[model samples]
Target: MDKRGSRRKSAARKDGASRAAADEPQSRVKFWMRRLVIWGGALAVLVALFVGLAVVFAARSMPGYYQLKATQTAQTIVVRARDGTEIVELGPSYGKWLTSDEIPQVMKDAMISVEDRRYYSHFGIDPYGLVRAVYTAATGDRRVSATSTITQQLARNVFLNNNRSLDRKLREAVLAMALEAKFSKEQILELYLNKVYFGGGAYGVDSASRKFFSHPATELSTAEAAIIAGLVKAPSRYSPTADVNAAVGRASVVLRLMKEQGRIPADATVDPSAVKLKEEAGQNSVRYFTDWALPQLDLLLPETFEPIEVWTTLDVGMQRAATASIKSNTPDGAQGALVSMDRDGAVLALIGGTDYIQTNYNRATDARRQPGSSWKLFVYLAALEAGYTPDDRVVDTPVSINGWSPRNSSGRNVGEIDLRTAFAYSINTVAAQLGNEVGFGTVASMARRFGITTEINTYPSMVLGTNEVRLIDMTRAFAAVSAGGNSVEPYGILKVETTDGDLLYEHERNTRSTQLVPDYVAAGITDLLQTAVATGTGRAADIGRPVAGKTGTTSSNKDGYFVGFSSGITTGVWMGRDDNVRVGGLQGGTAPARAFAAYMRYAVKDRPVEQFDTDLQLPEWQLEPDDEYMLGDPEDYYFIDEQGNLIEPGTSDAPREDPFGDEFDRTLEGDRPRQPVPGQRPPQQPQQPPQPQQPPRGVDGAPQAIGDDFLNEATGARRDQRP
Candidate 1:
């Protein structure tokens, strides 16, 4: 019985132990559950702390982070020529920022329908839009349905780079909320419009309006407004200038959205044809002038200041005429440049090359080519300084210098010509000779003082333009002559302002003095250059105005140039190949002169007619007798060699008496010298027979005979007996 009872107890105890083991497993499960709960609660708290910190930091820092309020660097200033013709439109002023109130109602509604339908209701984050965005992203369908409020876009543009990151997203969201709190909805819209970048280097709506349409933002039409609104999302992709089709498509979307949102009547059929866009007549085509002016501005102002309004002297009328002339008259493969400047050194008009769109090479400011005979202006100046008058006779004769023989273009010697006629005819031989006689160094110095910075070769041939010169330099030099010999440096920007409309810097005309040529000498040269246009090779450039100019045709007829000036403005034109290839039959009188004439015809159409300031009195002594009639004695004039060596009268092969004289003495006999044979030296002249011996002569101190041998030795040769 006891054994049975003990076995029972053992069985009972085993059952109890089993029950305890089951309970222990249950307790372990309960403990694990409690620990999990604690851990989850702690993680939740940490996450909440992190999110709070991120929001606080972003709100406080993001607004000011990259909000760079660059000073107002440009102002809307009107550029006009001396004749008061509008030439160039300048920067934006009066705060280009536009609020929703400032924009057309249609534009505002279009923005809302396309950008964020629930923008007014969202508290900086749109859950519905987020879900849509996620679905699109996952499905690989690029449907941009995500809603970014105006505040968010401004935040992104101002403070964030375009990187897709969770941190950036969170910061953007937090900053959006912060901005909503700090600024009104209208203010946010204004900032967004002003801060967003438009295409074509434009940073704001104002720039876009002016650059694309040559109008103000306030003047945008429905089509124009729609196009501009469409650009806000993807400027480069929808820029009217870069991709007009894409812009039109995007604008259609905006118009459709506008209609759907009841901003426009649903029944209102918007004319698709009304969206026909015309690029501002001269937009994107004036790069040459801008390029020419920018560098000059850099030199005119401090490194930090870029002016808001640059009151340039560019005359839009003249520029248009010049461009039209080049387009209409210039042949294929022909390139050209035109520059016009006022007498005060202000640039009035400029066309750097034929096509700024097809090429970026600015011929007016960048190209350096030989000036050819156009360079004789400096030669004339040097001659005037050397007491040689334009009336002074210069003989166009066959001449050689260091083995180089310069000939007239006509290839016939024009005997006993005056300086004026020599210049008028562009006589190469006479020019080379004059350059040689007046000292090539002197001519080069005059060119340098007149504002030519390029190195000019000192060789006498340079007087006929063997050196290369830029149109800008030539224009400036001519302006100096127009300004009574005072050096005038070309300038573009008059002042620079900060983005906030504060004056940062200003430019004033600066002059330097050096004896380049006497004022009267420059005037005299100008007078002769005037005659070049009036009745010489430059006659093609005559515009019925008192014009002064010089034509240039380089070797091989490769380059053509015409640089001229009216009483108030100076212009320079050049035509040549960019590749440096010879252009077969082109001369200065063809394309370049025509271009100048065309530009001047339009430029001066409205101006009160004026003459060159002849009253700017030069000395009478500076005036040379007009070479129209040869009145001076041939002996009184001198001819210059290629080395600028002044050869005395009756020295060179130039005919002293008229070779075609009426005396008619063709049959007159003259002595002739023996000619040498082709292959052998003249048969050693037969040894002269011994001459008869002469008697001795006595010296002052003693009797001494001076024999013929002694005389021969003293003279280095025996006297010729045959007379």
Candidate 2:
């Protein structure tokens, strides 16, 4: 009886333990569920508070309504080349603003169908589209359609910034709501059409229509309206001026969308293959020229912001040629600028650099660099005006002014050379001598008279072109020499006119302009310039035509220049580094001269070939009898001994005896008597009496009288004298 009672008690204890274990697990699970519910509610409240604060912050930063309604773009400029071909359109262009009633119905329909399907139905934001976009984004799929309607786009374009952030989006949404409240749906559509950007610098529907189709917006057909509407999504991609085929395809997409929305007929279709785009010159390097000319327009029409057409003097063909030549010839790691103009100062082609897109600095008109030897134009002009002819004798020996010695580029000078030969070889000593003789002040004055508006230092080195002058100024000076001696102020803008054909200003010829250079002086300078190109330092610039230009290389080859003219067109080229670093082997005669030749060849291909007037009657010189300077190699004669005796050819110590034979030995003629040959000696000749030195012959070949100061004491050669 005791054993049975113990077993029943133990079984009851086990049953109690199992039931307790099961109930403990259920209790723990209930506790965790309660904690999860409490935390989730707290997180939901925090998110709501954060969103409320963000929306409040965005609403306060919105732009004013008055500012939104005002014109966004103040002005537009249409730059046209010389032949009426539009080069580029700068700044956003806003054409005639059309009201809701003036906008074509098809254009409105197309825009509405493509941009916002529920435009008339929605207040400002499309709730259905917004919901769809949010749902699609939540599902991890982007590429969702735009949720904002036409009102939203206009609000963003006119007032709000394009920052892709929550704050910007919220601000855009609030602005859209305000715009919809202030303007009706029709008015909103009109403002959107007129304010949105259609690429190629067009800002409004009318401007885009005129830019792409060359017609007004009201005249747009269904296809044209579709094309214009398609540009709203991606203006640069669909612009006809950029890519016509892509624009046509986009138009087809717009038409399909319009038909689906029941705005157009169900069977309505447009052929992409039949689309014809207006022909426009590709936006090219002409932008550099327009950039330079645009500022001048401001000076001519100050305080004016009206839409205007700028008629420039740029020759499209010549500009293209100049751009190509500069690009191909400019050395690596170097920059170049070019300016070409007619005799009357009409700028034909102005290239700021090799690639304008890479850099927009207008070196041609802006950079003031040392003109180098090309500045000798004034020094030589001063010489000619001082009554010194090209044939005047000047020795190319070493020269110094106040202890500053100028050396020739060759390091060896040819003594007793005429001015013509000295100028041809760019002999530095002669140029320095002439500049000093004529007075540096006179040279500077001559430079100013020829239109070098820069400050001219009357220092000795200034005559060698140390003064910094712009390429355009130097080219202008050359143009004065080429234009029959009248100075010209370089002008690029021919006229400024309103878009409606009202002329604001036109470049007028100054009939009362005085001659800066005398006719005879100009003709005389031409004689020297022609000889320089024919057989001198500027040989690389000769293009089988008469080209009279000068080459300039500054100290250490830092700057190289070639400026010349052909067929009444004067062009100047400059090559250098903006950082002022020296180029290894750059010289004016190398790249600059070649580039000049290349451009001139094409620029004057069709123009009539003309020659420079070089018929100036220059004074001639008769050679006075003197000991002839041997002009051949010393190796042609037998060697000499150390004791000053000639050695026979076959002797052992003959050929190797004297490295330089007696030909170069500097000794008096009578002191160093002539040696007889080893074989047979020629018969003796009678000595003639000394002849008196005759006066230099004038242009008429008559003996011209001169003063004692004009004669070189050593050579008895008459030097140039001031008149």
Best by TM-score: 2
lDDT of 1 by residue, 1-723 (tens): 999999999999999999999999899999999999999999999987886676666666644422434533332444444354445565443336565566666656666777877767775667788888888889998866656777677777776655677887787887787776666665666666666666555766766777777776777777777787788887756877656677889989988888877777888766533665545433544556766675564455554423344545566666678788777766578788888887767776778777664555678887899988888888888887777755556678998877888877778996766666677778898888888888899899988988898988897588889899998898888777777667777766555555466765566666453445666677677777777887678889989888888999998888998888885788888888887788877888777888888888887778777766433244665443222112123233344456644445446575344322343233111111133222212322233334323233444544223334344433555244412
lDDT of 2 by residue, 1-723 (tens): 789989989888989989989999998998988888888888989976875565455446644444545758445888888888988778787788888888999999999888999988886888899999999999989778778789888877776655588987877777676666666787788778888899767888999889878888989888989999999888766777656778889999889999999989998766754755677754477877876787787668754547899889999999989989998988889999999998888899999887654455689988999888889989999998887766666778988899889999999987775667777778888899999999999999999998887888998988778999999999999998888778787888989888889899898886766798777788878777777777788889998888888889999999999888888999999999999899878888889999999999998898888888865643433232223222122223244466755454345645455332364254322323233212213223335433224434556786533313223422444344323
Taking all chains together, the TM-score of candidate 2 against the true structure is 0.54
Superposed by TM-score, candidate 1 places the C-alpha of residue 301 at a distance from the truth, in angstroms, of 4.6
Return the top candidate by lDDT. Answer: 2
* lDDT of the candidates, in the order given: 0.69, 0.79
RMSD of each: 18.9, 19.3
RMSD of 2: 19.3
TM-score of 1: 0.51
Off by over 4 Å in 2: 1-68, 93-283, 617-723
Give the Å error, residue 597, model 2.
Answer: 0.4
Distance from true position, residue 676, model 1, in Å?
43
